[model samples]
Target: MAKLLFQRVADEARPPAILGRPGCGPPDYFTEVLLDDLVKSGAWLDLELKRPFLALWVNDEDFDFPDWNDPLIAIDQANVRKFAAMDPVVDLESLRGMRVYHDEPYFR
Candidate 1:
């Protein structure tokens, strides 16, 4: 299911993130249940670190989680320029090639 969702964003490239936010559903569902399942199940799977996913757990005092979101950014100056060069008005289609999985509210 996750792979399919990512493939929808970029057929050949990897996206930066896979956001899990509650939308009209129980807040606990996104804030707790999913992470619990992942932690228990993550050990069963094997994944490489390169081109890896930087999972972010949104921290809110009201909704606590067993895990925390670790900062996953590790880029040089040149990559910053490459990202900055993007023009939202003209380069909307270029995101796929960039492999940036944004965690902000869903938008395309």
Candidate 2:
């Protein structure tokens, strides 16, 4: 499943984005949940590691995930950009932090 999500994100050439506040609650599991959803939907895109913010991009520009708006996700887009700029090779690290889980089986 992790490989599939990575492949989808790499193939799509879009980075997965994540957002979170400083010292927030437990490592939010939303990213993992969303990753499962994206893979199931066959829309998993690239993973973007912007330090405080990690994001997942779908093929569509307006694609919206309820998780994106979660307060646990980052609230400031600038912070995300800062992280991205600081480390261009952010995806590699982001992928490592991701914890793939076994949820409802997804079929495409």
Candidate 3:
């Protein structure tokens, strides 16, 4: 029963819409799911660590900021420089397990 429900949820779930600027590649469905789970589990804060730098999503409702580290631009950038300089495919796959931060401070 639990397995059936999990499958159902997975099937019904749609990837989060990527808005604003164009992204470098296809939508990261796995990252979206992990982000959702982190939000639900209360393990995520507003700040996310993409790699070497820290960043906060500008407007999660409309768009997700490119993941990055302090002194780093994008997660892809850090990954490329540090890990997958020669293999893009491998770098993309590695992104799935990266830490995603949420619950950023909101200003009115």
CA lDDT of every candidate: 0.27, 0.35, 0.30
Please give the TM-score that candidate 3 achieves against the real structure.
0.22
Worst 10 residues of 3 by lDDT: 46-55
Measured by TM-score, the strongest candidate is: 1
| Between candidates 1 and 3, the TM-score winner | 1
How do the residues 29-96 of candidate 1 rate in per-residue lDDT, one tens digit apiece? 33233223233332121122112221222112211322234321222122222322332112222222
lDDT, candidate 1, residue 5? 29
Q: Count the backbone clashes (under 3 Å) in each candidate.
A: 3, 16, 8
A best-first ranking of the candidates according to their TM-score comes to: 1, 2, 3
Write the residue-wise lDDT of candidate 2 on 1-108 in tens digits: 253433333335333423222343444444444443333344322233222224332211332333566553343333333333442435433443344432322222
> Each prediction's TM-score against the native?
0.23, 0.23, 0.22
lDDT measured at residue 69 in model 2 versus the true structure, 0 to 100 = 62
Q: Model 3 shows how many backbone clashes? A: 8
Q: Rank the candidates by lDDT, best first.
A: 2, 3, 1
Which candidate, 2 or 3, has the higher lDDT? 2
